[model samples]
Target: MQALLKNDVFDGNDGCQYRVVKTSSPNTGWVINLSRAHSWPVERDFGVLRSHSRVATQSTACAKLPDFAFYSEKARNRANAAYEVIKPLILNADGSENDDILDERKRNRLVLARADELDISKTTIYGYLHKWWSQGQSKYVLIPGSARNGQNQTSGTSGRGRMPGDGRYSVFQMGAEDIKRAKEFLEKRYIKKEHASLKGVHIDLIAKHYSFRDGNGDLVKRPEGEHPSIHQLRHVLKTLFTPEDVKRGKKGDKNFDRENKPMTGSSLEEAVAPGHIYELDATIFDTFLVAEANRHHIIGKPTLYLIYDRKTRLIVGFYLGLENASWTGAMLAILSLAEDKRALCEKYGHPYDPAHWPADGVFPAKFLGDRGEMASRNSDRICDGMEATISNTQSLLPITKGVVEAGFHAAHCAIKDMAPGYEPPMEAVKRRAKKYHLDAALTLEECTSLILGQIIKHNTTAMENYPLSPAQVLAGWNAIPTQLWKQELELNGCAGANYTYDYLHLQLLPRTTDDPKSKKAKVTQQGIEFENCIYKSVDDDPTVRQWMVNAGMGKSPEVHCSYDLRLVDNIIVHDSKGRTFPCTLAKDSGRFSGYSFAEVEYIIVKERRAKKLLEDKTNQAEMSRRQRAQAITTRAIAATKQAATSAARSARKADTAAERDAEKSRLRRLQTSMPPTNSESKRVGNVIALHSSDHVEGCAHQQPKIPVEDAAERPRSTIDDLLRRKAQEKTNELTHL
Candidate 1:
């Protein structure tokens, strides 16, 4: 015979099932009739007694309890309230009924005392106790008979009426025919692309069906009291279709399917272990960011690509950049999955122990992402090289990658309030003007640090509602992503694939030669040139050197290469034999280092525009200067030609070398001895005047005289002395002749 355990159900020889609610002794216990009928006499049996003799003859079976989830909140509350009334009598400290209360007189006295304190009859309290003891000794069994029947307690409109305080409106009870008509009107007019209002549709229904023609054969509205209210129509509409169905009708199938569809399964359903499946998705952050080079220049919101582990809910990898959602950004994010977490965190200035984020170098068996990135032809590298399958979500349906989508929301919420240049809500924007870009304070690197911190926090913190497997629960594994990942890896023996970072990076990076539309990198005398930036062979690879030699020999060698747009510092150049060579940015292209390919391209374009504008202004100034010089030269040439006409050619020729020299000397001396010009005298006089009242005295008429000693001490001009010496020599030559 099986031992009678507390709460164990057993079959008695009397053809009734009993539950052991309490053990009174080693061989005896108090039992309750689990299969008791409502018509059974409660007082005739003060519960049942189970002994060793009864257990020896009876069979035991597992008890099947009711699922209270289906019960309404009111029903559950009523059951709990009734249980509170008899709790002290039935339940002891350890959840078993007290043996002292097993006596009929003692139990009745307690019941009567409870009834009197609660202002209820003793019979009512007895009924609650009998129901609790007869129905498996559960609080759920204390629910009222009407609620347990699963039928409306009141029959046919007994409790149905206009709610209290509803202004003098008449209550119009809708019949079957009225309901059918209302559903038709709602489906045709309200729940449609037109999105008609409920009140408007109700009015239209009245105009079409409930209205009568007036004396002049014109349609007229019926009295408000005679028609059903809009609320009645709305209630009928709700009964005919669910909220999702109504949304589908109004917003079209695609919108409802993407946003309003019920999620019956989890993103982890297909994930068997920590790295079984990974979800990838990208979103443009709401806040703006400044450029790493120049904080004054506002770069529009950066796009964040997240690689989320479905099984552990860990953010394995991410990429933050100014680029839009494209394959380039996705490639970087995928590379981050196998990147060193310690290095990545340190690079972003959020360093922590590797144990805190242990998803480094773990590759998922399958990659799931949106069509924008995963659907590209470049994504084939993930399948062919890494041996992983790519699963792309359907277009416009972000819910397919719901795990990563929620991750983006979590990351955004973590930094939204703290981040500078955060975009205000649409309602706030509508209320007042705001330029979020102008408020941008964080650089691209700083934003990346913030996002990294949030990811680390998420990975280390225990997640809410993480569904743990039975094995994990038995082993006491925590819900923290890092802990779950490490525990699962240890138990399951590493479900993720493994590859070196360099090897995987090379395989996954997009190849320019593979793209027909993109220009391949050309090897020239300057080195391998890509995207207008020169990449020289940093490592002495024979293949790269040969290519450079051939390029210098006038052969344009086009090399197949893969490069990360996020980092233009280096690129992987593939030789004809499929061997790769590392190439670094040339000295000339060193300015482009530390900048993304998009930023490099932007810088090039901007610089070109600025240079062109400056050149245009320079050319305009040069042209203006040339025109002014031409005008001055033309005027001087005309004056010289006019003066030549006034001189006689024969008289000029008759003059000897001595006379010519003497004439030049006399002119030089006369010009030097001449008094200062009126403008010059006035300029000097103004300086010596020194008084505002002496304005007239500082004019050309009041020129100051130089003293004889000062004038004599002033040496003759060099030109005048040289002329006098030349004239004396020329005159001596004439006398000797």
Candidate 2:
């Protein structure tokens, strides 16, 4: 194995094809033969040999008996029976299996024929024959030569393997050149927005229109009809249009002028400036929800509004709560452009009277928007109102609004599909619509702010092919003015025809002892609670208070109210008193505009010393006590360590004394002497005396030492001596007799 691998015998682009055999030593009987074929011909030949011929050839002994080899009765009988059972199963010329022959009923019938008894079950016969068939018993079957032999039973085109594209449409079919040419023609003829433009019709419509007789009046083949795909159109436009065309289109509506002048012949063809066009449309937001505590229900839906902007697509205004955004809402949203300009003025401390603004101040001279009912039928009522408001700023005619009506159709086409979903719920749709409004709103305060922030981003960061954010493009325009517009601001001591600002009416708040005197509670005319609040009004006349009450500013005479309202610069209400406080303009707070929510704690964090001072003294004292406790614990730990060392030394000393005493006791016990001499002498004497006195009584060698009779006469003697004396006396009497 190692030698073959090292020689690269099996390494080839094609997989290993040749067979390798393994053997144990040189034994022929202990060999394993493995075979493989690289091609189908070789594989089929081997398969035929194994399945049909049994791979057998005649030996010399069998060759001499050729006539009898296959002619024997047993062999002929087996061949006839196999042919009868297998002839019906001969494979056809086609490469498909003979499913009918392989069916269970047919196979069962074939098996039953060979069995002599008609009653023999097909299952039993199949089992009997199948076992032998699996073991390469080919003699029990017959092989038909090739499927070609049965051509009559098969059909045309034998499924000998084939590859794709070998069939129909071999020549003269539409190819890549036709597609390329058609695309080139479309590019030259159409407008190039990602969305469909006025110039490009649906492909199906175009094809049908062109399908009519050609100039030669001959029948022409028509290509399949299709919609002009946005992808295909974009590619064609990119190839055909120059960057200048795109830049011109982006500048804005070429139809109207900033002075509300309709463009003349040349101006119609000329590019409108970037800041001249503002389109407005509304989309609903899906996720907007407002809970109604009174009804325990939610007012959840999207609302419509429009975007007001110049050609820069800077957002200038947005109107909310246009319930049923019909013609009314559309008009309202449009009208907000002037209001936005006014608000910007008041915020800048400038005269917000609409008559004072430049001709281009309010909004784009031409409005581009959807054709909702509100937008479509914008009436004299709406126009006259706008005219009256802007009459103070400029006497621009309102006819310019006509230029944007037609643009609504294009806006619908561009925006509706781009909304969140296909016919999304109104809420989501409205929100998406507001994105355009938001873009327009940014233009209201300072067009430059949006341009600097987003216009730069769109150009530098985003793909140039797509439109940049209004802010992105605006960023390149110019630095923004710091002022914002405002409206209805109360003047400082300036008397109007019927009204004037009044001194603040102070409402003393009920106080508890817990409340600090320095912290005076304040409540606005709106009944909103305020703390440490103060405001100044320009008017100090008492009649001003009566005028304010008449105008819904001061406390109601019939009903108790929290406080009386007085007007100020930007504040909705004034809170200063005339005598004790003497209303005066706040130098530091004069520019304050909107209410904002902030965390008091968060602001206090900027003053570290104040924050530390605010900490409770009790807590500080407790912390100091805890530190002292920790210090005492450190000292106690040191004392414990010293005591532990002393105890350890004392224990070691006691252990050493105990060990010494134990050793001494063991030595003393070992040194103690035994009385061996005296004990040994006594024992030896006793043993020697006992051995010499063996003839005294009942001795083996001697009869008696002291007479047995004498011993027996002494009754106090032991029983043994008495018995021995009796026996001796009897022996003596016998001798005497």
Candidate 3:
């Protein structure tokens, strides 16, 4: 007992100092010697503030304060007013009549002298009694009129208050008419194709109608008129209409939905333990990350995929990369959740004691996500393999899993006041009308470190409405998740849920084979080529290829290969049992060697941006080339439809100037062969009949062939007839001349 003599001073929850009168056994607790009667068992030795005040109401330090019933100061003030006004009526007898006596006094009242304690009058006390008696003595009915029907976020003045939607003064006795005109003007003048200026409404009002009217029936313009003042009207509009009302239909649908979409559906069913329901969600982090090679070279915003714990408001795992929400990012996050993060923290130079982030080996019974990546085919197979059921939330509804959504909100709030390199929220971006990439200052590694620190800080923070801090849920008291998770694992076995890194990795990735049913990869001595890159099998010997050939169902069985789309550097090779035997890469994979999938995509995206800028000017030449190709195609199409008979007819037309030259050359050859018959035979007329058989053959192509019976029926004896005909033609020509 002597040990408690000097250090017997104790601090109560109300911040009061008390002397310990007596010690007690462990179960009974200690007793405060002070008449205040504050006694309780000691909690964790985290230290508490001490105060000299006896009354808890007098304590100023929050550390010295205790968790108590939430008593409204406004309600207490009303109660005090009612008590002051009703005290005299409860005991209005003379002072000599023992009105202050407790034994002979009124019920629920300590004394009538309490009225003099506060500034109360006998007349006011009588009024309060009459009102309470009229309202059946309801405690709420006794509230002061001044404090009744109070609302927050409204226009309430200290001494005098204006009605809602009113400016400095009450603009209108009613709200409907004033609100109607204001809304109509806002919709017509502000929300338009040309986007009328917001201030135009004031100008229109001034030009169209004045505030007051004169005795001569002329409109008068005065500041003290009946109509609302310019400033007051502007205030009303500000209080009523938001920027979204004016900017609707002028922005992307997704942007609008993100900002204004209503949250629907209840949260995921409460789970029994940790990892029973893993909420998977992803979003574009509102910060720019830079490349390692160039600090100022921003890589735009990165997508952050989080595996959140629903039961514990704790983030189980996350994956950040310059890729969109796809199977690769989702799988990477899942893989991170299943593995030990000690190495991960060490790689980032973070002081990870594993006492605050106990997230590994917590296999989920079900995975919850929205329609995007959660509905993907690959995600379905991976979750199935892990014995995790997949639940897809309704489209555009992220509130179905409020824990993760709240986690994202917490993260953004933590970084809202950070330095440059963080992207502005949509409102700021809309005002500036530009992206925040140019303002980037944080490198990828630096931002990642900051994020890790935030995750740790958030997990350790003591949250309200929770049994324990997120860290302590898995850890012990004053211990975080990192330590608690390991402690739980040590005490309890695997709990029928465990997976190896290799096994989980293979299952999370998509697979394709060379089988006839599937688009299989061809196995060769060099390697298997996929995604414009080669992936060599470490065991691609002749024996393996032959085994693939002979041990197959069909004539030539194909090799099944699985690869992570985010990294083409390597792919896992699956044997007949679907077990991964080797991880391989291209033989000469110079540039692509050990490159992340996002890095490759970055290169392609950068080049495409450059190409687009260049093409705006080069498009004319490209158009011309396209036109030329199209013209040639059209001509070829027309030529293909030409008839063979028509083409031969045109080819046989050798009776032009070139045909005459060919005839002369033929005649010269005939003259040489016939010994010229004489010099006269070499003349033009004799050259014509030199080869009658040749003339007949040349004319045969131009003439139509008649049947032998028709020719025979025409005429016979042509020699003498020909001589008579020639003589007759000569005689007719002379007669006609």
Best by TM-score: 1
What is the alpha-carbon lDDT of model 2 when measured against the actual structure? 0.36
Tens digit of per-residue lDDT, candidate 3, span 1-737: 11232114555556455443223432222323232432322322212323232333222222232221233678666766675555454445563322232222342253345556666654455456445433323455465555443432343122332454635455432245554565566566655434566567755664454456679987766453344445555655566667665455444345456667666534534554555678888888888777789886877888878777665566778887877888888888888876767887887788767666666656677888888888977776655578778888777656567778877777777876884667657745476566667778877677777777788887776555545547655554433434434444455332325677666887888777433554456554445655556565577655455644554534444566777776677777666765554546655654777677567667768878999999967998899999999999999878866634555556656568898888876765554322233446557545633444454444433444566876789866879699999999999999998
Residue-wise lDDT of candidate 2 within 124-168, one digit each (tens)? 455433422222224422222231144233222122223226453
Residue 414 of model 1 has an lDDT of 95
TM-score of each: 0.49, 0.20, 0.44
Order the candidates by lDDT, highest first — what do you get? 1, 3, 2
Q: Judged by TM-score relative to the true structure, which candidate is superior, 1 or 2? A: 1
If both were scored by lDDT, which would come out higher, candidate 1 or candidate 2? Answer: 1
Q: Residues 116-187, candidate 1, lDDT per residue (tens digit)?
A: 888988887788877765555676777767676624222222224565375656566666566667878888
Please report how far candidate 2 places residue 101 from its true position, in Å: 92
Error (Å) of candidate 1 at residue 85 is 56
Angstrom error of the Cα, residue 190, model 2: value is 22
Lowest lDDT 10-mer window, candidate 2? 481-490
lDDT of 3 at 299: 78
Report the alpha-carbon TM-score of model 2 versus the true structure: 0.20
Per-residue lDDT, model 3, residue 598, is 62
Name the weakest run of 10 consecutive residues (lDDT summed) in model 1.
39-48
